[model samples]
Target: MVATKGGDRVSGMIVETEAYRGPEDRASHAYGGRRTRRTETMYGIGGTAYVYFVYGMYYQFNVVTAVPEVPHAVLIRALQPVEGVELMRACRPGRPDVSLANGPGKLCTALAIDRSLDRADLLGDRVWIERGDRPVSAASIARGSRIGIAYAGEWARKPWRFWLKGNPFVSRRDGMPRHVRAGRKAGGGA
Candidate 1:
């Protein structure tokens, strides 16, 4: 519930999210309401974490938002992890104490988020994006293929992904190296 210069937690948590429509939204794991116990949270409003397990190892994080009951959300591909950082680290221990809140998987890991958080409101204190006043420009935002799932075909190519032009804590994809890549490589649906 602590708000920061970059809007509170979830505000920035949701600062950049990809809107994956129904099943047609090829990139959406919940496309077609593929309710499989893991994606059930996608059906709710914007404010909760839509967490799911992948590769039997990593945990992908998302923010559930939109009209209640309407399945939609913005995938939280990455984060700055300003709030509750020690707690975040408790959830994700690194090989050398590196940030565990940068990548989509790391975000969830750092936050200790899993499917159990599904349907939990973002407006609540346990988890939420505390929106900021400033607006991140679309021009400053970059577009590129979402990470790890290039095999999604056209879904893989759709550049619904987004992020601040340059923030050291944000995640990096194959298209761009964290420090050397020019411009930003957009991400996929939230």
Candidate 2:
């Protein structure tokens, strides 16, 4: 959940995520320890928001994971609206409810996420994640490659993307048949 610029709260259940391992993952902004003004937040402690602008158009939201300096983060890909649905609709007018937060950019727009919230403490009042009302079983999660990183070479094929199986709100299908198994942890927000 996150508070908007107007102080209204918008919340959703995360249904899709993509993990980016630092230094090693070619798709990661922190790859090869390339620290800059924008990617510095990825080096922060876990639970920090590493929001960034991409393609000069959209702001993508990520949750820093692991201990400090790890630079591991999870990109929030899709969300299932749980609160402030009407307000979300107002922010993204004319879109169907299922499409409101079905992608990273759309999720950020629906929740009013932007660079201003970069490095924000997710555990703080402005933004925070909560346990979903119901548990998601391992068998219900599909694992596949991250999207829109074809230039990452071999790293583009890594099965770092996870989403709820058969969920209508998922932004796009990854075309993988594998499912997460019990006891296997999906790093950075499974």
Candidate 3:
């Protein structure tokens, strides 16, 4: 969940994620050990937010992972809305709840996340990850190639994307495994 300065709150279940290992992963913004002002937060300790703008418009949200200096982060690719659906609908009007936060940029827009959230502490009350009671079995997780980075060559093919199996809120459902798609068709549990 994330609370904005105006006190409006938006909450969701993180259903999709993509990993980026700085200095090693070509698709990462901090690739090749490059450390610019924009990527500095990515080098911070784990639990730090690394929000960045992309394509001159959309904001993509990521959480710094691993330890400091490692620059590892997990991109929050998709989210399932849990609270403040009306606020989210206002932000992204005309879209269904499932499609509101189904993509990285869409997730940010739905939650009002922008550059202002950069370097924000994910462990803080303003923007924290709460523990959910839902149990996710290892077998219920699916992995696939990261999206929108074919320029990274072989790195683009690495299966670094992970999502809950049969999750309707997952971004790019067409890219999911055959079994997952079948499960969704059969109305299997997410």
Candidate 4:
């Protein structure tokens, strides 16, 4: 859940995530230990928000996940709208609730997240993560290669993307196999 100063509140259950490890991971903004104004927040203490603008348009939101000085974070790839559906629809006019936040940029747009909230504390009132009811078991989670980063070379093939298997709210389902969607091995499916 995140609340903007304008009093707009959006809440959702995170259904997809992508992990990036700093310095060593080519897919990370902090790769090679590069420290820039934009990536500084990623090196901060865990629980900080690392929001950045991409392609001169969309803002991507990430949660700093490592202790201070170690840049590890998870990109919020997709979310299941739980509250503020109308507000989300307003932000993404014409989009159905299921597709409103089914991607990183869409998630930000739906929740009104932007560079203004970069470095904000995730435990603060303005933007925070609240515990939600357990919606899926760990075994139901599926791992896959991160998306849209083929330029990262071999690093792009790493299975760092995690999402709830069979969740319609996940960003993309094209590559997931039917058995995985069914929460079973290929041969185990009835």
lDDT of each: 0.61, 0.88, 0.86, 0.88
Compute the lDDT of residue 33 as modeled in candidate 2: 97
Number of clashing residue pairs, candidate 1: 23
In terms of lDDT, the best-performing candidate is: 2
RMSD of 3: 5.7
lDDT of 4 by residue, 43-158 (tens): 99999899999988999999999999999999999999988888889999999888999999999999889998899998787789878786577898999999888889899999
> What is the number of backbone collisions in each predicted candidate, taken in the order shown?
23, 0, 0, 0
For model 2, the stretches where C-alpha displacement exceeds 4 angstroms are 174-190
Candidate 3 lDDT tens digits, 49-153: 999999999999998997989999999999899888888899999998889999999999998888988999987766767776687788988899998888888
Candidate order by lDDT, decreasing, is: 2, 4, 3, 1
**What are the per-residue Cα lDDT tens digits for candidate 1 across 1-190?**
2322223242224323455665667677766668766666777666766777887888766666677667777677766655556555556665223355667667666666666666666676566565545666667676666665565678777877776666555576434734554465656324
lDDT of 2 by residue, 1-190 (tens): 5555467778888999999999899999999999999999999999899999988889899999989988999999999898889999988999999999999999999988889889999878888898888888999999998889999999999999999998888887555333546678656343
Model 4 regions lying over 4 Å from their true place: 174-190
Clashing pairs in 3: none
Give me the overall lDDT of model 4: 0.88
The TM-score of predicted model 1 comes to: 0.71
Q: Each candidate's TM vs. the true structure?
A: 0.71, 0.89, 0.89, 0.89
